[model samples]
Target: MREAAVSPSPLSPSPLSSAAAPPARPVRSPLSGRLAGLWAAAGARCALPVAVLLALGFLAPLVAIFAYSFAPPRSFDVFRAFSLANYAELFSPSNTVWLSFAWSIGLALFTCAILAVVAYPIAYGLAFLFGRWSSLVSVLFVFPLFVSENVRLYGWVLFFIKNGVLDGTLKWLGLEGAPAVLYTPGMILAGMVYTYLPFMLFPLTLGLSMVPRDLIDAARDLGANRFQIWREVEVPLAMPGILIGMLLTFVLAIGAVSEAKILGGQSVIVISHDIEIAFTYAQNWPLGSALAVLVTAFIGALTLLVFARLDLDRLLGRR
Candidate 1:
């Protein structure tokens, strides 16, 4: 109203010359700077022991196995002379190793599949059936490990022998005969299933317990049938346990020499047996090492392919 000359707005900073001015920096004390440095140092120091252990555990053993694989067949004393003769003999048709390995792979696959089917129901019971009995059931499943592998194998031997349970049952059933299950591949699979069933069950129970009941119900309400719920909802969610159990069961079963040697009557010639024969009976460490390495490489490749194909995280769950 007075018509006085208007001055620049007091609150507005002049952008013409002040555009280059920096904003206020965060305040930091010398003590705070020292503390930041100390925190980083502490973290690094804490990590050192773990790093050392990993180097010893993960790297050292792998390096030793690699060295052993390439060692000379004639003498273990030789260093890095580089020979493929052991590998050549390994793949030879006369060895029966290829056939043996194929059989072993078959047994492992069959065992894993059976265990998966058997364990799913048990896990389902533990998750949905047992309730207050869940802890007892889980304990019962784990309790058998205290029996020892040798004892477990021996027990199967007793059960499968000519006059064992099945034969006894046959005698009672008026058939008066059941062919001996002992020393057979079927016996081997039974033992495999008995021993490793708990592995699949425990993990699967853990997986199932994690999946909410409401989620299953919601899917069902939306027209998801029992098969669809399992295939789409339950399986996807429980994939971590299933995949882990499958891998463990398969890998361990494929490497099984004990069940075959002890219960299957040593008639079974598996890859593990091949490795053993090369070392024990043949006294050819180099050949054994090479065969071992080859089998290991094959399994390692298969595991990688399976994990990649399945998208491992789907099994691991969303963290």
Candidate 2:
């Protein structure tokens, strides 16, 4: 038996060799590597066209306006001459532009307050009560947007004008005629609320819809009242939409011109009206550009502030 024993063959595998072997790495071709890199950047590539369009349409105009703001007052030397005269004039003690700014800010704030109160109930109804009819209700709200704003405002004018629909109807029914409310600040505010109601409502509805019903039910089960549930669960969840709606309405209201012109009969001049005058009637393009720059700065700053506080990832559901 000792003589019959033989050494293992030189080429034979060891018992531990297979267990000690490293994993085989896949060999990647250059083409495959390039394709993978492209796939990784696919999202950016897809967004390139939209980015280009925004640069051209939005950013270019803003740049031009900013450049024009630094030009000499009442001058067309945009990008050719640079001066601080336009801005200086705006900040001068004699300038009444501040009045317009105050008016605009006041009106915008009032409009936001009014819309927030008016739209919430409607939004709540749309989100919870009008389940099957929500789409139809939304369409109804949207239908007015399809009509020209000026046209719709004019329709209101016809309805509110003396001896027009309201007054005539009241006289026919042997009641007191409609009050002399047209061509007033109250009227302008009314028009703004009417025009911006849908803007506030839709966003609120969207925000409310994002709130989980189960959480609401759980809160109710935990002895939470309707107000508590709203404050504790609904509001926190729907805050993003509410903020968006308010911001949007505020922006639109601040820029409103036609509402004041048509409804208030220019009883109060707003900043937008001043800008229009500088551009059109006064032919002071530089002044208009400077005013526009200031407005843009204010809006941009406020928007940035709001966005800084907003959790966009949560809003977008990334979290």
Candidate 3:
């Protein structure tokens, strides 16, 4: 009677007591599950269409050019097979190809340098000083777009002609004679500056504008002068825009066919003209393809080199 059945306490410590369980995560909605599946499927569905279009449109044409570069020249029975004739002709001292290339590169480099130097100050003025008038100035800078290129070229041709605006002004100013302004390197330079100034100005303006005023003011407060602040703060910050504007100008100048052709009076031959002659007059598709390919590769390389010099992280660094 005294020996009662003993039962273990329900609250006694168990194996799970010391080991805390992981917190339960909130369950996702049915819509979220469907959205995840849809997102995953999108790339697979779109990839083929995009790839096919690119391949057919751009890739195939480039491949064709490469293949044509290996093909025999038109009307030539000799060297009827693969040969390095096109590449060899590119460097032939007897031809204008290499000279044109050199001249083009030089002109492009000069133009970019000029644009950078000229635009930098204007950009600074617009960003800091001419704040209210920036928009109007920008519009005035880009207003040349209203004139057609054909008309502009012809107008310059007309103006630079004998007894035209330039000569008339020259006589009125007491100068004996005004030399031809069209078909000269000076003319090309003037045209380039006029056409591309906006390109330089806008990118530079945007880049300089992005430089935080707080950092600049802080630098000033810390006994930094204008020159020091520019060198240390503005330069590093605005470098990306400077590089970009220069790159665009360089590319535009270098690849120019029309400017040097019509405006140049066809007397000065550029590389693009050589390529055109190869394809059109000579009907030498291989040589044209080779020239085009080489020019494209060179431009691509130069652009890449310029891009590598810019440090984006540094530009966006904390003040």
| Steric overlap count per candidate | 1, 0, 0
lDDT of each: 0.83, 0.93, 0.80
Top model number, lDDT = 2
Score every model by TM-score: 0.83, 0.88, 0.79
Off by more than 4 A, model 1: 1-37, 40-45, 78-80, 164-178, 306-319
Q: Rank the candidates by TM-score, best first.
A: 2, 1, 3
Best by the TM-score measure: 2
User: What tens digits encode model 3's per-residue C-alpha lDDT throughout 1-319?
Assistant: 6999876577775557536666779999999999999988997788989999999999988887777776665534333568777778776778668888887887787778888889899999899999789888888877877887667777877788789888889899998768767788777766667667877888798789878899999999999999999999998888887888888888888877777776777767778888898889988888888888898899899889988997766555543
lDDT of 1 by residue, 79-104 (tens): 65777777777778797778988989
Better of 1 and 3 by lDDT: 1
Q: Write the per-residue lDDT of candidate 2 for residues 1-319, one digit (tens) a residue.
A: 3688777777997768867999899999999999999997997899999999999999999999999899888889987898999999999999999999999999999999999889998898999999899899999999999999999999999999999999999999999999999999999999999999999999889888889899999999999999999899999999998998999999999999999999999999999999999999999999999999999899989899888878889887888
- Model 3 regions more than 4 Å off: 1-34, 42-57, 75-82, 172-175, 311-319
Q: Could you tell me the TM-score of candidate 2? A: 0.88
RMSD of 3: 5.5
Clashing pairs in 2: none
